[model samples]
Target: MSTIELKNLVISKISEVNDEAFLLAINTILDSKSESILILSDDQKSSIKKSQKEYLEGNYFSNDSVNEEMEKWLKQ
Candidate 1:
């Protein structure tokens, strides 16, 4: 089923459920699972890993440079 259909079904089920328990159960069900499979290109995965390594190694740009670029773009 499509997302809209799935959402409608969930809403219908929740409506029949007791209010107090429904919210907690829904929140748990909606939380992202780390074990879920994802598809990414090798290059994309490599890029992410490289960036993560850089962050871990403390090789990063200062906030000043990032803000300067953002300010320049905002003026354009």
Candidate 2:
């Protein structure tokens, strides 16, 4: 389901819940989500842009291939 649908489902479920403690826990989680702001430095931003360019050029390794190589190296 989409984010909206998932959110509506959660809201519906929470409405059905009558436990005060459980509602408090959910409120705490929502509060923490609002506080999660991230600030990236210029160097980090440049690195991310470079990585995105490389990805768009199809220059990245496949997850399965990387795992296979890691397993082989670990066995050495």
Candidate 3:
């Protein structure tokens, strides 16, 4: 179906729904769709840049090393 037709169908179906929980879930989904864009804090932006730089520099633990560490941690 076309986008407009689909939207009208959803609106029609929503109007018929009487369950409070279901209505609330639909409201939450709609609200999420209309949410404003997120703005990252300076610290968060800096952290992302640092992580990217580290990744580019190859200053990161190997998968095996991380798995070994995780295994040791799980044992503890």
Candidate 4:
């Protein structure tokens, strides 16, 4: 079906829905869909940039090293 037709069909179906729990579930789905944008804080942006720079400079630890440290910490 076309987009407009599908939307109309959905609206018609929604209008026919009378169950409280089902209506709440549909409302929750619509609410989640409406909040699609992600807004990051300035601190989060700065941290992401710093991490990217460190990764490009090869200043991060290796997976093996991190695993070894974790194993040692677990033993302690």
TM agreement with the true structure for every prediction: 0.37, 0.52, 0.55, 0.61
Per-model root-mean-square deviation over C-alphas: 12.0, 5.8, 4.3, 3.3
TM-score of 4: 0.61
lDDT of 1 by residue, 22-54 (tens): 788676767655436688999999999999999
Best candidate according to TM-score: 4
Candidate 3 wrong stretches, greater than 4 Å: 2-4, 15-25, 32-38, 69-76
For model 3, how does the per-residue alpha-carbon lDDT over 20-72 read when each residue is reduced to its tens digit? 99999999988988886788999999999999999999999999999999999
Clashing pairs in 4: none
Better of 1 and 2 by TM-score: 2
lDDT of 3: 0.95
In candidate 1, position 64 carries an lDDT of: 100
Give the Cα lDDT of each candidate.
Answer: 0.87, 0.97, 0.95, 0.97
* Cα lDDT for residue 33, candidate 1: 59
Poorly placed runs, candidate 4 (over 4 Å)? 1-12, 33-37, 72-76
TM-score of 3: 0.55
lDDT (tens digit, per residue) of candidate 2 on 1-76: 9999999999899999999999999999999998798789999999999999999999999999999999999999
lDDT of 4 by residue, 1-76 (tens): 9999999999999999999999999999999998887889999999999999999999999999999999999999
Name model 1 segments beyond 4 Å from true: 1-38, 68-76
Give me the runs in candidate 2 sitting further than 4 Å from their true place.
Answer: 1-34
